[model samples]
Target: MSSISMRKTTLAAAGLAVAGTLVLTGCKDGNEEVPAAPAAPSSAASAPADGYATPPAGGASSAAPGASAGGYDGASGAPAAGGGAVATSGQSFKIGQAATIPFTSGSKSGQLALTVTSIEAGNPADLASLNVADKVKGQTPFYIHYTAKNTGTTDLSFASVGHIKGLLDGGAESGVLLIAGKFDKCPNESLPSGFTTGKTQASCAVALAPTGAKVTGAEYWGDPYNNLNKPAQKGLTWK
Candidate 1:
């Protein structure tokens, strides 16, 4: 299979298990700390083929469009009506707010108005459809429902807008759970063909909170925001 196809297959079949502890730094809120624990091990069992990969720790492989310009609500840190203004790096927002942010996938670059609509608790029993191992299945699952729109001039078809991660209470990052095939509970998909200006798509990301913990927020660390050396800000957060 081609690299793109392989990546899609990998995303669909199973979740990516990080091999070690991850220490986050430079969080403006001073709450972006992850507890020291061994990373979840990858499951040996295979899933039925057919899904997209989780957004990589480095970045995502696809891009989406953005929302129109407007005003910023200082109190809630969200964009006002008409989609508001393009968000700067490191900005914070509330649930249901929209952030018009920039992103790049390969040679494609564009603006995407991403709205993290809600973070809902999911029943662990629903995970039976996935190929997750029992070792990690005990972790609580949270579904991050979001919408992405192309607000730029580029055609970002097949590009994914999936850099959002789940945050536990006290701001620890949650483990990502990948699904191999179609997940009816929280379906995730890539931008379809002809995803030009004004095009929009809705998707979901699965975040697994450690047993006994609760998910309270999410963070977006796409593109220049993830760059450590540059002066650009680090990431955007939402609660």
Candidate 2:
């Protein structure tokens, strides 16, 4: 209750208030400004996670090559050059006769010749074990063996032989199947899957229907790429 004691107490209380104000000001400064996190790159953020664009319509995409829109070669059956015409001519032959046929049109320009050296009925036991077995059930399989030589500037594809056919004794025409070796000493040379120009005669085979059903006539369906429109190579008689 003394005057001196009262003055000292009041001074102490004022100093404490000032100190509290300073502490609060320091805290406000600390909270006043905070650095922001860096923003993500816009391009990467907007891009797809996998980094692939949607495929184009018509089955065409930059990601894929050589896929046909319709899943097939166009009806023209011709492919533009690399070189050559839009189509070509095909040839005919007797059972044992060999002839040099010129392909005048289409993407391939060449002298491709074929000789059907022998024809034989496929053995059922052996054929049933082959890839063609499932394809030729009910119909007998015939092995059509031939020699093919390519002597032109462009390559010729013997893979088209699947289109060749035979007329049966009953007048039914059957498409040739996969080439297979039916026996030893078949005299058929293993032909190239495709013939580059200047290649020598190569052996090839095709399977036809109705085993032991005589193949009275042989026919070629022609290579559409070569633009061949020849009539079926007919009058082919085999024993």
Candidate 3:
């Protein structure tokens, strides 16, 4: 072959060799191990759907109210013999009993024309559904119904003032009662039947709408607020 022709043949052969090598690499398959792709992250390992916040991802949280310092468990049990547990300051009532527990606050010690519309007996679980401002429905049927009228001159503020007394059997703070907690705003769980709204603690001096006077709304202060730690407000002479 001519020298020039020989050189061309050599270049052609080199080109073919490169092409063949590329083709083989492109057709890789079967057992020839290919580098595995990076695994995709999973979604399940992400945040949960429990309406609660993830701790590690941010910070921990507790469901219980932070201000839960001192309170009572109104559903502990029945009262002692003679109906005097000392929680009521010597006051006692019969089982399934109801009363018009009157109270007052403000200038003339705001008079609370209050009464237990109904009172039932049971455990804490019984007051499970009792809520304020729509937190829970009438689930806690274990409390006494206290219907109070604002027979005073000011608006009933449930928050500023706490619970006074509770229904008791034989004098113990054993009867159904509202739980206790220091509230700073409209009520949530421990509210009374007479509470018209949770916006502001109803005033104890609420004048009856019929009379166009401000009055205090009712309250079911939970636990200690019910009658444990706090002293009972000396309400107006009710009976």
Best model number under TM-score: 1
> Per-residue lDDT for 1-239 in model 3, tens only?
99999999999999999899644533111001111123343221211111111011111112121212222343122242223121221222332232222233333233233343433333323222323313223322233334444433444443223333332222222111222222121111222334432222221110011112211222233222234244441111111
lDDT of 1 by residue, 53-110 (tens): 2222422111222321221223122442335666655566787887777667657887
Give the winner by lDDT.
1
- Flag regions of model 3 displaced more than 4 Å: 1-109, 127-141, 157-161, 164-168, 175-239
lDDT tens digits by residue: candidate 2, 66-176: 222222123222443222222222222346754444443334445555556666665555444344444455666556666655645676643332223455675465444
The residue-level lDDT of candidate 2 at 235 comes to: 21
Task: Give the higher-lDDT candidate: 1 or 3.
Answer: 1
Q: How big is the positional error of residue 48 in model 1, measured in Å on the Cα after superposition?
A: 10
Ordered from best to worst lDDT, the candidate numbers read 1, 2, 3
Model 3 TM-score is: 0.27
Off by over 4 Å in 1: 1-84
Model 2, which residues run further than 4 Å from truth? 1-92, 104-107, 131-134, 154-162, 179-198, 224-239
Residue 209, model 2: Cα distance from true site in angstroms: 2.2
lDDT values of the candidates?
Answer: 0.61, 0.40, 0.27
Look at candidate 2 and tell me the lDDT of residue 98: 48
